[model samples]
Target: MRCLVRERNKTRIGVTALATLAVVASGTAVVTAPEAAASFPRGEWNETAYRGQVEVIPAKDDRSDRRVLRGKVFVDRDRDSVSDPGERGLRGVMVSNGRDVVTTDARGYYELPAYDNMTVFVTQPAGYQVPVDEYNIAQFYYHHLPQGSPELRYGGIAPTGPLPEAVNFPLVESRATHTKDQNCVIAGDLQTYDKTEVEYARKGAINDLAQRHDYTGCGVLFVGDIVGDDLSLYPDVKDLTKSLNGPVRFLPGNHDLDYDARTPEHSFDTFRAQLAPAYYSYDVGRVHVVALNTVRYPCTPDVDNPDGKRPGCDDPENKPTYNGRLDERQLEWLRKDLAKVPRNKLVVIASHIGLVNYADEGSPVHQVDQVREVYDLLKGRKAVAVSGHSHSIENMKTGDLAKGWSDLFGLKGLPFPHITAGAISGDWYSGQMTEDGYPIAVGRDGGRPGVVTLEIEGNRFRERYTVTGQSDRFQTQLGLNTPTYRDWYEARQEWNANPEGPAPELGDPHVVSRDDLAGTTWLTTNFWMGSTGSRVKVSIDGGPARWATRTQQMRGEDQNVGPEWSDPHAVAQQLVHGGSVADRSMHLWRFALPEDLAVGTHRAEVTAIDSYGRRFTDALTFEVVEQR
Candidate 1:
């Protein structure tokens, strides 16, 4: 960001009303506004000495009856840590104690029911910027743990003696963040298991992000599984944040849980201590993004999994498991949070486990158990749900249906767009090594590693996923599926085992025989984010374009699975290189050519149209021969 973000703005409310608070206001030290759009020489946070922390004022009176946590959300006018004269409190900013949410009053003062080990945080309101540390981590919350976390591995939060008298949150008014146009990045699953995978992420996705300057306005929200099971690597994850030029927020996934904890209440304490609140919401532009901790760890059948799908929870010998369910407190908190958001604003519900997933559509444990309730809550609102865990990219629009959704969720069609943002560490960063020091790590459904961006102007949005190491123009992967290829596909069904004889050679993917044309040969296009309303058109040798048929109709049918429906292009790589096969994608489209076409070279001009009416064109050349 070239321009300064700390410039003062004209006031709306009079100064007389600011008398209640002493010190006030803050804005970005350096941020690129849409008006003054530009990039920084370095791909790093716009950090400066203006970095600030939350103010924790010690208590004066000690009656030992502090049931409610009280604080003020003030604009740190001087960017000082303390609230002084002329600095006014910001009103209507929501604050939460990790559960119950409350908004600040006209005076920017708020009181919420607090408990032990709770984190009191202010949801950084739109048009305002929160103070960030040198590491660019947002400093908006105060952890209140009187006794600290119990002794365990990775050393949890240290002890704090008592709750503060007032925990004032300091924010700066940033025109950089105040704009109606926003390109909010909704990235999912950078689940690096160790240092190697961490390095891969740095070189792959993080490096790709550094070259772009689009997200400084609204910033980036990593939807969960920030790392694998190792809590110790949080610092390494922070190092990756250095490459970004935007404010970053995180949501916890199942792998982020503290498995050492004996109970569910403490499952994510380590994550909260190291990263962010287990669940929270913030506003940017006209969108209210709700980041949810959907993975419930140490799930018990009695409370967390009442539906009985998690039968292992009842077994004495079984290790405590995780399930896709929201605790009562979070559910209640979501209700309150959504109530405050106006009907006109777009509500983006971001989570780790998707509300509904195409990859794990039949598994009860993979999707949220309270999907119906979530849908009910989102009624009469323009909303979208984006999640990560599945590792596949799916763009399911409203009115799209699946049999598993009908059978398990009792959902015939989606209430809103439910997109499964493809992972940064695609398939756990597994596959043949790349020259740039990473893996191809193609996703299970053939989608490559990528990040999803929601470009919004006011309340509405257009979504797109950019493949890592590739430009945004690259969207679809084209391939050929023939009768002979299917035979080789079935022979290589054992994904890990090597064939006894020489593997069948698909000599030239472009070459086709009369037998191939006669026996249901198809031209496959893997449009990663394609969905019900998306279209794929093919024109043979520059002839008039014809629409291609989508493999999985998504009209209340089970998975249109196996080799025939698989992305043969991705399958060839996965079978030989590594990772899950590209069988049964929600976005695969196919077109069959006429069997009697004259034997000659042919060119297929492909055009893919997304639901938002964005058009992308690609082409492939092939040949029709008398014999193979």
Candidate 2:
């Protein structure tokens, strides 16, 4: 798959009514680097008004050169960035030496001689828009590095010595022009393990994109995990992009990696060659999009380290074992990238690894290192950082930015928002099958597999999550704890029990019986559970339920940690009272029916289950009508 580079768009120099911006073998026209010129005229800038140009005049003594090449670029009048049939190439479109100018050929292409350190940029015409990154930074057409740029201590384009002569620029004709006008789509991890799963994604996402035209105008940005470490699937992903109505951009994830990346520099060589800037900035409308590379490849192998080592970088074993962090260079580049952006413009920092304090706060593996520094960088700006890789949904509205980093660094609440965009693959390789016979990667948090859309007006943006092939109705929050749920859970537990001898008889998977409904309480009975130390609850007829203390400790099959004496999942072994059911999988929850109920046909349902082990109810039943 071809990794496309969508760059940051900065303010383009505005060229005036100059008919020709040409520089010949010099007589006396001053020739210096372009950046030495004044700021682009603010009021003169427009989407349709093409500006900025450079003259390729040779040195005074060297008059032997006769070849003069020149061309002009504008928002493709026909809207195709590439030149096409019947579309007139804009002529007389001025390019300059920051003073004098030149125009285009019949083909609408422009050129200038190779010059040293010249900042050659296109003049944005009136009523046309430029592109930007999530950080609201504009993209420069080309760095024009003839000798190549310097190596950035942090990260940036290497310094190329000079701009080459055949300097032609491309522009997609955009009409509705405003610094504030832009649209963007955010896609989380598209982790597919095999070709079948790739086809599954094709059936799900590709089918959805084929029908979407709204996003065609802006383009799509895919947050990492493009492939499940199996880089071979990238071409298939590229095939999927053809279905997209707009340009496709990508940021790398742990899965999209060079397994041989022993050091940080080699981390994304494969990805860089495929995608654009690994951690770079681009602009669209008033927003600056900063895509970051957060998966840090350890230079030192931990193969013999105390903790268990992982297999291939794509393997599931490798994920949790490795910590996610932005290397020192990326962090530095971020600081500089942000410094260039105006504070008023909205900045969207996109990364594969989210900041610390995700699902497992204490676990450094899930969080980003130096996150506090990252958060601190956006102190006063209107900014939001979005990431995916956790494969779950969490919109943490925390004023406390350093809640996860305070101990390590003296950091505090962040001034902006950090949103963890839910993964497109949902629970990685888990989920049921869809009608198309593809495994449905339904999100564990009840969110539908989809993309996020940002509507920008001025510097303000409203973010909306769009589910693939479905309407907003599919966006939901699951509620638990009705009497029906209690019975279903009990039955579900019994049904899913691992076969020690034999499995239970087949019955209605959704039904809740009176016996199971009695003492109607269901526990989450596992280790990953127990928020704030809350446990099981039992209740009947929507009344208050009492908590059930763990008597016996049960452990997961994979559990081999410290002494099982304190493991909550291990402690829940008491409820495994009878029968040879699987230990860790069986979560026993119980609730008793109300005492005052004059039994006829009473109904119960588990409507909701909270993090605190609290369960809500929605239940009803028909009594004998009192025989009046």
Candidate 3:
């Protein structure tokens, strides 16, 4: 991935309208508009109605000379990318060269020092909009890799020898961006390793995206792992984006790296060329999104240290190593980027490796190395982070804590929301294939393959998860966790991998005896997106509802793992079919059974209320039989 650079100057310069027609170079395209008087007269500034022309001049003789990339942030009145005669420029619009951010002048012109591997993009300012391609993918940036990338397995950017004189960005008036309320889809890993998995993604989440139109302005942000390790599947990824109903943005995951590249500089050359910048920021409504590149590959040991111990790849030239980290350059850019954003606006930070996770709870390698630094940067702001490397769904609220985080980083509690959006390619496309031709890749935490949506109202936000091939009402999975179920869980693990007989069954989900209740019997509910503010209540046999306690309290306690904490509903499917073991989670809740209950059939009504106060109800039946 490309590094974020510093801006040379914030002062904007005015370019005189060309009296003569400039010849465009071969393989170059020029877009121009009739010169109009500057909307904002000298000494007076209007945020809107600023006007300018977009001119493309031929390259000069010096191939090595780095030129300044000058462009106009014009208002595309007709919604066409080309700046027409009636269209005007937008002043104070932020533009960046993958690093430094500069505002458009009164005339709407912006210039930044250009480099070989920079991507110059205009941040979608509030009340303004950028053009979307045929696939509803935002087309706001211009990649400036004049000579393209070095030779690789999957082709990187093709050669574009000289820089164009004008790299204009067009925007139209948009009320959707100014509205207080908005819906933004945040999807996690679409780790499709091959063509079949690509189809799974298409039928699964991509199909879901096509059916939804609510998220128009903020759109969908796939938080990394767009494809599996195979970079050649990028075309298929592009094809999948076409199914989306709104603008689609992406971040890069460890699997998306170009493994063949020797240096970290070119690790994501193909990704940058085909998808988006390694790191960037944008705005919609009162929310500012800061997409970060947190994966550092070929992580070598510090040879200078006295400790002889080393981790990851010792010789990266032969085999690759990956870790969750942000280079110093990205951190600097983040500081500068946040400086421009208002403190009151809600900041949604997106990254591939999460700041913290339950999946890789104790492993420091799977979590971001600079968690404290990032938190310190956004100290007082209303911020939330969304990430997707671990393939599990998690919604950690403010003040929540995990034992791993405390033990590794000395962090006592979370200061803001940190959600790990569940993977789209659930459990790496494992398990039995569904009727829809996709695998029922239930995650390790019992979270079904799905996407997370953030419903934002000004500076406050509420998050919800939508499981693939299911309705919004499908929020929780209910199961009976008893001694019998625990025995079945163990037996299935021992025999299911290589079965000598019929697979071990989980018996009847609704039948339990006094002996079963005498042991460890309880009602378990896996609230897929449950967080601190959420609650789960159970009402047995039309009695008063009693709140079910969350198994893992994010109060600095160690994670409660193993079969006792596993979601029996997930275990049933995973053990019988095939997939990752659902051994632990941060969202599972349980209520103990009443030992004094009379012998009879019992009906339990479960109600789960999310952090947003939205309620979902499900029912389960079990028999409390008399001892033989």
Candidate 4:
């Protein structure tokens, strides 16, 4: 048997390196040992810093300051963000000031106590749509940053001197958002680092979105990694969103951070100025989408290293790092947000770093640090989580487990569904070019690049992944895995990456020998969007269908990982063509070939059924030979 060896350091992509450590309140230095530090990995958390003492700045009380902002939710006939005289007010619309939620009166007029740095937004009412900016990003809220940001790069919210008499929000009536059946577009990392990559995205997923009109109301919620470190590309991202059919909303990923900012309050200031609020909630049909800020900068002090080589709390302003965590403020806001939502409503939590993922299945640092706390808050509520940043597509059903989560977070199983929406810039836009002029940037799990759409009917939802430029039925890839395939997988990884001589060739993916069957041979399937409650069945030579076992059971066992768990189809492509390794996957299924089968050509028909009971079928033909 050939084993695929992966370099640990290179395995993790899109995560930033650890910068420094900080001092704790007890005057002890926080550090991480060199050996243990490697386990922490980089890229996931970057630019985080630690401090001996963190000052809790109380949110300003607008009422105490004798301030009240009035606004009218008007029906914008023109669909422009600006309110006009001909437009009529939309009564009964909900509005908020991050804490209080109120409904508009008969005249569509409402008042809220507004304070400095508070975002006052209107809850996009069912049937009425909010106006979008040039980037097609919904402009439902008006940020009030009285004094602007305190000394920061990229310039935070501009100074808005005094509270205006009114801050009106405009909306347009739309049949798309009124019905219970809605399609919400969920796209993961569009981590375009440069303009060239931006063009690549324009031609790829963005182009696909432009051609489709399904998600017009619920709109597109890009779950983090909107851009690679270059905040300047936000405008370009906005421009790309213009091609989308729905109003766009964005959650800030670690890469979207203001790295030069000194404090948590100012971490996403630049993001707020350009895109949507750092974290907020909106309603569409029966679903309440709560976009949370999970990337915490200048994470808790590490207590094992003292060379000051790592970013630390003493000089946090200069050395910053990031971690997947939810601050007290955001959690408090979440509590308030959920309070307004009905008990039976389906709560969709959106963030950049995932609550849990298979890509970093055993890494506590990559998953949300406060997962238990968040889960506890959502107790008894029907909920689902969607995130990006891991660059891989994951559909973790209720009760899924990983050793890291159980060991670090004490989480034995998932309470609800958590889906990591695959990246649009798959594998950082790596690998060979395609006829469509984009790279076949397959993910680490071997899932192809795509965007996930949640088709909702009332509180129940079904997820469907649409690979860029492909139909919805293109759900899985099938291949044969044998000793030869494994050996070729390993050899090709080194050869394709750095050509040493004539490239190694994999044998016909269809043919298998008796020796191959004797050694170890199996049929593998990469179900890009498969999740818990999903099943795969295979029928050989038109015979009775037999169930194929899911590799990672997600039933509190340690993650079933490594090359043995790799996706044979994706491994074949990535190893030879050059891209992220396709070793270890959450959605891979395998079926052992019958060793006593007659030597001849046989066809295998496979069917994959999702949690929603939707079935996708595919067929493959292979040969059972006596010998090579």
Candidate 5:
């Protein structure tokens, strides 16, 4: 929602922060933009330390004699991180120790069976908001690791000398979160691998979030892969979140795991220390969001990896691998957590790896192994599933079927809608650089980098995608997949494989010759979050609107891959510039153009109506030439 204007000096200047409701006479919230990438300070930066950390009162002893963990979910009227006298305790707030889910008593006091290395947290109830650090990271959990992490590469959790007298979670009342209409943002894979990538993220998605004010209550959930493999960058990554105005919550992805850890239990110790619990749940308005740790790194061979590709985990001689499956404890926690949520409330199940997706539809190592079980638990309830990991944007509705999902899981169709909320580091932040300061990073499935927002009303919700550096209405990408372009795509692929000559050029993508029309040309529309009921209508030169057929219908068929199903708009960037090929997608739709058109410039307008009946418009101008 940040409007950026290019200055005469060719430097990008952000026009507004949009966080403050205050607007100018023109209704613009003009504020200074983020400093340029080079402007970032080197070395350690804990600028957010002034905001303070999670509240705790540790015991004087190195260890505790207590067998139970106690905490209070109290209202912090003074806005301090600690609970003060006369600040009333909030009643019935959900609290958990990673496994058991329990609610506070009438006094806001709750206890859970305490164990070593447990994270005790309280879920912020509707009308209440958990305090966020200066970096905007929510501080609601206390990691009770007596001896700390086992000397991890990132220095995992520090030694918690002893259990605290109380791990009180403070909350402030919020009018934004108390309402039935909530816009919750779900972002996939900020996955910045280094400081450079961190700058890219800050300029791209982080900047987009900094300027957004609609999600102050429900907040933003970074589904997984908060960072790539380098855990040391966690501090810098946290700094990027400083721009956010909402509570930032994260679930661990395979990339976030401690690869050196020999045991799966310790795989995410560092993540827990720096970010969040491996799995957690919270409430916003009438929606109950359950974030699950679906990635099991160092996966043992004994566990069934049905139709998966993870080669090893049992051998100590080699590096441990990861599989998409929930730990038994986490699975049980999900069951217990859902039981307490009201049946009338909408349930949003978020995870690192998707329960099911078009990108990894056939690989159990990428999709959750216990998807069926998870579905059964949410059965008869108004629930939807969301995830990251695949880096593709998929909006699969209930009953939608994919051949891989069917073969891998022995499942015929989806029971609930499952969305793969694209990625911030699209294609690992590959492709050509843009003036906006990041790479094109078009996803393998052809969707651009973006974030998904679920607008919930009562027990129902609608999903909308906002592309990075773009507005909410920027939903569709249009390109011509003409015969000439497809051939150039193949030629470029071959050239990239063996560099003897210059790469093939996708010349004048919008302009196609008569030969191209004679051979065949289809107008491709990459509708980022398009689903079963979505429609794409194209009108040429203000003529009647005509429907475009979706390339892959997601109806029990295999992926319609290769150049034919590719988005030329995305492929042109991927092939010549760099990054993953946009060779396949479930959201791409194609409409054939008339071959008998006169040789001249023509204009076409596209109207894409999503399943929720929200309409978006885009247009393309092209010349019908006699020859190239």
Candidate 6:
């Protein structure tokens, strides 16, 4: 992986210094008169060259200085921080710090009295998507100064003082939907980097969802990587998600960061401003959905290289300090959130990164490091975690957190399944193009570039994948395996490297074996099992038959730039490499015939059992050609 390099034209986009004060007598309230507000500060308010000794002090017993609040507003019209003339003084916009609201003056700006600990946010109007950063992370809201406010149990602004002056809010054309439904859809990554990629996402997946109306019970949940970079594409994304026949919710991925963020506190400010929540829980039917920001951005400064060669890279200083860990603050809030949820509610913890190993071989940054802790928190309670970022499908079910060491983290196997919702883009923009003129980016797993539906009926939910306009059978694919096919597989690699593009041709598996098991187990399978008794076990003549290992880990490390983040899947494949194709010791199994009795021909069959114990079998018969 390449290190993130800073471009030469790096300039600050928007920076507004705001002073907010909220002063009120105990059990008393403050109100502004509608008509008498004529004398209040109006138009773009600027405290030119104001510095130091600023505090939100309580007003003394003198019944004076109550006319208006003094403050300043900075406009970032062009969105690059250096406040220019044309970009300044945006008028007629309304600004509110949670409680009170005020409209801007004719000069495209306004000023309001300061209030203590108010969360200043604009009511994003229709037709526009908020400006985000290169990572598609939103850019809105002013950071609360003086650090921590009186913390609320569930998190909101504290009633500290009066509101700030010139508390300006930025607005854009939004294609937002205000829908209230019970049928829900869960979508994974829509990580489009540019216009072409955005079109790929729109045509490949969004176009497919556009025709879909069968959302199970609620709207849709897009679980992160909304854009690879180029936050400008967000408006289009908002339009795409709006195409869905439901409400859309979002989470953040590692790629969705403001690389320009000056502090750790401001890291997800843009994301929170646009997406609404970082680690919040909402309810629908008998189910509760908790969206989390597992990518705990590092706040500490870069100390490893004083020369600053690795300025913006996620180096030792910038690496996500806590993997899969909910910071003490978020954890505390989560506990409170869960308290409001009943024990029997079907809870779905939706995150951008999977709780455990993503697709067996894991990507360090995309899989939560502290999966066990998250698992243990939900132990005994019926729960499932749906994640994206690996761009592959891996449905893991290990049975309970008590197993000690988790298959992905340090906990034991889980009591529920942890799913990596396959990506909408798929393979990071690679592979063959389809008839639709888009790459067949959907993973080899049964997953396709569409959406997942969860039919919630009380506490129990049923899940299914809608592969564009195709039927269930079309959504899944099975591989054929045969001896003659094995011969062709061996010749496929070397033939490509020759100067002459003319390479060896692979024979038809159907013609080679006449055995039904020809394409059965050459690679892997996405069983897409429901939450029940699904089991996949294979044995050759009563001997152990292991599943094939994926050739690539699905994600790579930027080790060329920083310290390696360990992944369990990569470590597993490395430990078990290089053995005979027939060796049972190999993690990936390949069978060789038993020499003594097999001279003429032989037969082998593999079986698969679903949750209800329903079985499907495939068999193959091949000649044991005698060695001359």
lDDT of 3 by residue, 204-295 (tens): 98898778878877889988899888998987887887656566788899989988777667788788766777888888999998889988
Model 1 poorest 10 in a row by lDDT:
1-10
Please report, as a residue range, the 10-residue window in candidate 4 with the lowest summed lDDT: 46-55
Specify the poorest-scoring 10-residue window by lDDT in model 6. Answer: 578-587
The CA lDDT at 591 in model 4 is 93
Writing each residue's lDDT as its tens digit, candidate 5 over 1-628 gives 0111111232221223312223211111222112221233332222211122344554445456787877678886655444556879888888988889999998888889988878777777888777665456766777777777787787777666566666777787877678999889999999998889999999998899888877877889999999889998888987887667667888999999898887777899888877788988888889999889988878877774433355654553385688889988888888888888889999999998998889878777788888889989998999899999999999999999999988877888888898899999988999888799998799998888989999899879999988999988899999999999988988999999997976677778989899999998999999998999999999999999999999999889998888889999999988878789989999999999999878998998999999988899999999999999
Better-scoring candidate (TM-score), 4 or 5: 5
Model 1, backbone clash pairs (residues 3+ apart or across chains), number? 13
Comparison by TM-score, 2 against 6, better one: 2
For candidate 6, give the lDDT. Answer: 0.46
Candidate 2 at residue 434, lDDT? 63
Selected candidate, larger lDDT, 2 vs 6: 2
Per-residue lDDT, model 3, residue 175, is 77
For candidate 1, the C-alpha RMSD (Å) to the true structure equals 6.3
TM-score of predicted structure 1: 0.91
lDDT (CA) for every model shown? 0.80, 0.48, 0.78, 0.75, 0.80, 0.46
Q: List model 4 lDDT by residue over 1-628, tens digit each.
A: 0001112222221113212323221111222122223333232111110101111111233333547777678775543233445668877777887666677888788988777777777777777666554345666666667677777667666664455446666666767678888999999999999999999999999999887877877989999989998898887987787566667888899998888777777788778877877888888888888898888776545521232322343445566677777877677777767777788888999999998887786665578867888899899999999999888989888888877777767887899999999999999999888899999988898888889999899999888899987988999999888877877777887786688889989878788989888878888988988877889999999899999999888776776655568888777778766678888888989999888878999999999998878899999999989987
Model 1 ranges off by over 4 Å: 1-50, 60-65, 495-505
Supply the TM-score for candidate 4.
0.83
lDDT of 1 by residue, 521-578 (tens): 9899999779888899999988999999999988889998988899988888887776
